[model samples]
Target chain A: MTSAILVSILMTLVAASTPILLAALGELVVEKAGVLNLGVEGVMLTGAVAGFAVAYSTGSTGAGLVAALVAGVATAMVFAVLTLSLTANQVATGLALTIFGIGASSLIGAGFVGRTITRLGPAFPEALSGHPLLRAVLGHDIVVYLSLALVLAVSFFLNRTRPGLILRAVGENDASAHAIGYRVIAIRYAAITFGGALAGLAGAYFSLALTPMWADSLTAGRGWIALALVVFAAWRPARLLLGAYLFGAVMTAELQFKAAGVTVLPPEALAMAPYLATIAVLTMMSLGPKSGRANAPACLGKPFSAS
Target chain B: MTSIITRRRFNFGAGASAAALPFTAGRALAQAPLGVGFIYVGPVGDHGWTWTHDQGRLAVEKEFGAKVKTSFIEKVAEGPDAARAIRQLAQANNQIIFTTSFGFMNPTIQVAKQFPKLFFEHATGYQRADNVATYNARFYEGRAVIGTIAGHMSKSGQAGYIASFPIPEVVMGINAFHLAAKKVNPNFRTKVIWASTWYDPAKEADAAKALIDQGCDIITQHTDSAAALQAAEQRGVFAFGQASDMKAFAPKAHLSAIIDDWSGYYVKRVREAMDGTWKTGDVWGGIKDGMVKIAPYNDAVTPAARAAADAVQKGIVDGTLHPFTGELKDQKGVVRLKAGEKASDELMSKMDWYVDGVQA
Candidate 1:
């Protein structure tokens, strides 16, 4: 392949991976705090519509990003209240949230259909971003850089920081953390809210940066893929980033091959590449080394009540 | 929900009372305004396939003001869920129902059997029964028009087509586009990328970018989102919209569009149902019937390209140009049609092979 084609492929890969990486990172933190929020899909949808609507009406992409974060947090709060406060079943609530998100986002985004907005542009100056080779590294929007920074920040917080240690303690053993007066429920709530915000930002990336248009189900199950990425990464932020890019590469390969007139496989088979890779990686993780699976939070998916 | 139940019960009770009268009186009682229902496979907010159908539904409301009442359930899945939704519409006393996707064919037939008195219209489907009528637009005609324009404007002679699936309808479009482009420039090459979905914006955008990266100067799509057009606009390539006008999303990159206009057919069908003249038949209307409309050309298109596109559209409408005319060959160099003949609807409906110069 020519350098130009390679650059284009890498750019598309990054664009595709950023959203899932952002969402997966948030889910990693939520799971680390001993909560399994299955409502990521619904929350992301809410964020997507909220972001597009605000951006379109106000003519400000920044305001749109903020709205998306708030919407995602608000949607997550609904899940938090039902599963955390009301002691509802986490799996059932998460699934219900997804259904609710699909319906609610479509209803909310009904008016914004067919509307367009100025896309989120590059973070660097035109001279630097416009160069052929430099453009590959500098041409990405601000969210792409932010997503990478979040991966590093999250990695540090979970390992080096005191609060991070305490949060991990809460996830590892909520009863012990509660006995130590760590406010287990409150920490878990905070983690869930933070996760929701990141997920919202990821969703906003879809409307404000990725395609810059609003359509029903525009995220198109990428939220579910993000959920899968968390599992594939074994709930680690660093691994989550790697897994997102791997998935993005697999997805981009299908388009690249078809565009290049490579007919080694039918288009149908090519389209299945990403999902096939996901299953294969998950299988390898299970059948190979046990360290990855062993890293999963001990109290993950278990609802805790101090009373 | 309770109010709907109460209304249904009242309608049933009234129908029972009306049925108790003589046959002629019962027929007169059925004249209490035609109730029409529509079931969409996707959300109306898709702004493409489902949106066009919803527009047709709105036209029905406008055309028959007080004479008809219409309702719709959006995003109904195409399997068992479709049958349940169709049954619900039938039970609600809707005299006519429109199932607006090929996936709804069997479900529509199943529900039609249960409610023999109700009329059912299935779009882009071949199946029909005593109460079910099939309707579709010749979208390939629109494809040919845009292909002609692509031929004139494309400097590289490399056009990219983003397809949703490998269904015969989509295959026909790919073949039609390739044939028309080749007629203008024999060396014209077209690339086909299947996104395997009808409405995923992210995937559609990626496919468009991939096509543009491979040196395609023009892009066209069968997917139901404006993402491809937006991608083309961002990448500085030309594209044509599918199913609906998408000029607002990509003003500079959008050369023109093929809009599905179902208003005329919808109004006529509703009138027929109300007049007790509804019949089961297949209706495949194209440019002549005004079912398929090409949007206005962009100023970016050269005058020569615009004239060529107009000529092809006029020929199709006037029955002079056959998009699937004779002397055609598949990608394998096997002759599919002999000279001095036009492709019949039956052959076109089942087209599965690509034409020469189309890279699938």
Candidate 2:
């Protein structure tokens, strides 16, 4: 009975964490190339509504996921043009992107309100789902497996490739990359677009798999949580998966405590557990030791300019 | 023949020709399309409160036919967005505007004062003026019937209530339901969960499940969703539905539902307004008037439960019963109503505190 319950809970944790995992993976790539985009939430939400609206009308969940990615990438292109091409402040541009995305998505999603859509199929093959341990790890919507694979692929790309080293060089010191004849602006723009498409896919996972319904403010700060996960992972692709899943487990436990008939604390306190833990972990990581910030990219939020 | 006489009598100095008839023709053309508009705080789907109101709009169109032209804007925000929606409707030539929400009261009043020619009707609010009339269903009257069913059906003496906000309307409902529940079972206690938002299914479900985990076998809500019913069904507990009939959402678990029938009132008011006989007034309708109705009880309810609910329904409809009649205690255990006394409109309107037996 305990094992069955654990399996069910782990399955829920995967579903809950997919959007965050997909989004943070993209931001991980962006950060590795040395750009800070706070507009991740805004991009995710726009994708969520846009993807659902299209899927709802077209009766195609795959189409919906693709549309979400395109919407995310498109919004990122807007940011790239303004910040990368115009040399505008990245922080201000990202904030404006979020504000714009919120208003634009609301307007576009107005027609699809209160409509329901077909639920997406599971991510893994039925053969894999039949296995005990593999079932718990792999039985999710298609986006979940893709996001997990993305982390592994990103880890390999960032650590094992010459292009990855060049991107890192651009981030750590764009002046040094420029001396070596690397195109700094082009790399950052590509990173930003990649970040947005991932954020969009995260949003699609929400509408396409999680609730399968459209609602205002549906993402509910999942983007912000993903943003925080980047720091919690210390800029490592593999660590991001652990951080995202851990936060997902914390959230799932709070809900399951009531479901499983365990009433150790008031429901309100339990409801706040995940957010409180995030804050606690962040404080510990920031204040505990000098070694904590060692893994963060040195030029994570700094913008580069060529004279 | 009347036009000829009126044209000569009113325009005595005018020549007797077709050019003199242009004024009357222009008047007829000006009154060609009568615009009607609705402002919503949430999206209008095929379910819930906003959907129900949108149904009323469709009813108005069907009732009036081509006499009225209707348009709507959904998901209008509570404060400034409400004001903008109202102005847009009025400026677009909507002579009759229905602003549907409690938070929309002040904004509706503000817009009504500015556009005196337009008739504004605010739902679930008390403030009223010449052009700004307020109307709401006597939802507590429906609660009295459902509470009686819950009182008989609940194996545990604990009942759960999912309430939205601490305003008078919701507070009155909580008090009324607890009073009715206590009348049947003296040991009955209500666990109240305030969600603080009008339509959040996830929050409402979580709250309902929390209450059930705390030993509540029966539940009811003053919010606007079938989520509580869905939650109750998942937990194998029974609950009453709110705003609209939610039998489809949780057929087995839903004992019954309190349905808001705004069509009758909407038709009457719009007809009167178009005929120039409309007068601003509060229309707080109850079960007797068919504005509030109880849906069919589920089979899970015992024979005794059915009889009790039916008796209350008959009493309300036949004027033999009043939900707020006789001795009643406030949240402080102070008796607010004595035996043989009927609850006053003033007290019911300003009911800010919960009654005894309600755990907030």
Candidate 3:
């Protein structure tokens, strides 16, 4: 209950939430564009490994972040080519991509395993961020700020901009959007590419900012959690931010409470709290007046083969 | 001794399993190297539990040279899936397969029944069949040593334990560590955080950070990763590496490590199989037998801490001190072991309760 412990808990929560928020926000855009890409897990793994390997080699965390973006987009492009270009089953291809990511990352990460690197440091200097109370908000690295900013940018792009409206139009009714000369396929492609870049960044956050090391499946299936988050937020970027931080708080609280030596519940039950909360909230979302499914883009997951 | 194989069926079913062994010896005599297969729950590069087992695999290859062919399937999740992986090794003509994970117990037993002739060694499992054996290191002995170090070096009087599960093996380690630390500092407390998974770096790091932030100055983990050590390093807290020496991962924070040395056991077991001496039984090797070894003390480990840790290791090896000794009590003040008595293997094997001063 000390202020120091509380601050530490806050710090851990933000760090834990930022990566998922980034990935969820990216997936939110993808889903909004009427493309249901389930390969976020695989794409994130490729980004994590590529990020760690590049950062370890170049000794520049910046270069590592760039590599992660490129790797993520590249792997996402594979899904795009198969699903978007060839009109394959998105669900099956997404699962296959995850399996491929697991194997490929392990093979590439073999060398980087057992290796360590300089972790991303706070963006602000100690003068401002070192304050115990202020540290909660200011001590975070660049990704934390970037995630919040992206949420705003994504919200604006989807609602305020003309291109955003066209993109949403394509998702809502692709054939109609195509009839209106919106180039539905091209807009969807761009949205999918943007989503991949963000997911890749999120994966890099895990490798470079979070653990600063490489291991097989290092993202630990957080990509799937990000995918769930898109649904949890009903594809709203701002709500996605809320959901990610909420999930992070629950996850961190589970560990922090145990670390504080408070026996509120058995360890198993404590470990299951975040997951139970997720299921409960999702159920509520489904039963609410505005059913979450109603918010889904009509053409979502449907392969378009305009004959 | 081949007496470890505890089956007396004179029936054809038993005879068929026994018949498979002679075929293995015959194939070896026919100039075919003994095919040894290993299945790991984590990647070999984990630098922890599976990494140590993989090292043993390399040792087997080194000891036998061309007389043995070793192959491994890494990152095999333990479940029905593990059975498939184990069977794939069996189908590939591997004479002896090592399934190295606790969760692989059922799958290992099931696969051994099908490959009645093929020998299977499952690590840290309780089950054994005619073709299935279990072998494990006395990792508690290593824990006792590190716990002693934590007792002497910990300024916070609180140490963090990053645990993987509630199994006897993990619980035994927690009790051993808490007991040893309490022997040095009677008021010492251990905080245990069950991570559920053995090898998730992100979660492990978070657990370590939570503990360190909560004022647990010393961190020790039973999980199979160096992530906790790295977390402790970031926070400038003392830590003990698990399974392997991870000093390089956290040079400043690493006080010592409980190293799992399986190379000697693997070499001996492989040799036994080649000489037609393989049998199904349980083998629990400790410091005395070199199955568990303590790493060299870091410079940061004070002289007093080093002396105390070394004394604990020596006592365990010489049988002068037992971790689960006289007048032990569970957290609820119930005496589990009375004065002048020691815990038996059966008690340790099924240990599920936490000891006094252990907040798990």
lDDT winner: 1
Interface RMSD of every candidate?
4.8, 12.6, 7.1
Give RMSD (Å) of candidate 1 vs. truth: 4.3
State the DockQ, from 0 to 1, for candidate 3: 0.54
Q: Which runs of model 1 end up more than 4 angstroms from their true locations?
A: A264-275, A288-293, B1-31
Runs off by more than 4 Å, candidate 2 = A1-25, A46-170, A181-194, A208-210, A228-307, B1-30, B148-160, B178-190, B199-202, B208-242, B246-256, B295-307, B325-327, B330-332, B339-342, B355-357
Summarize candidate 1's per-residue lDDT along A57-156 as a digit string, tens digits.
Answer: 9999999999999999999999898877888888989888887887788789988888899999888887886666898999898899999999999999
TM-scores computed on chain B for all candidates:
0.92, 0.89, 0.90
> What ordering of candidates by lDDT runs from best to worst?
1, 3, 2
> Model 1: per-residue lDDT, tens digit, B150-223?
99999999999999889999999999888888889999999999888887889999999999999999999998
Give the Cα-based TM-score of candidate 3 against the true structure: 0.93
TM-score for candidate 1 (chain B): 0.92
Model 3 chain B lowest lDDT segment of ten: B1-10
lDDT of 2 by residue, B311-354 (tens): 99899889888888878777687888898798887889888877
Q: Write the per-residue lDDT of candidate 3 for residues A150-211, one digit (tens) a residue.
A: 89998999999999999888888988888867787778788888988998999999999999
Best by TM-score: 1
The best candidate in terms of DockQ = 1
In order, the Cα lDDT scores of the candidates are 0.87, 0.78, 0.85
- lDDT by residue (tens digit), candidate 3, B29-56: 5797777888887667777888888889
What lDDT does model 3 reach? Answer: 0.85
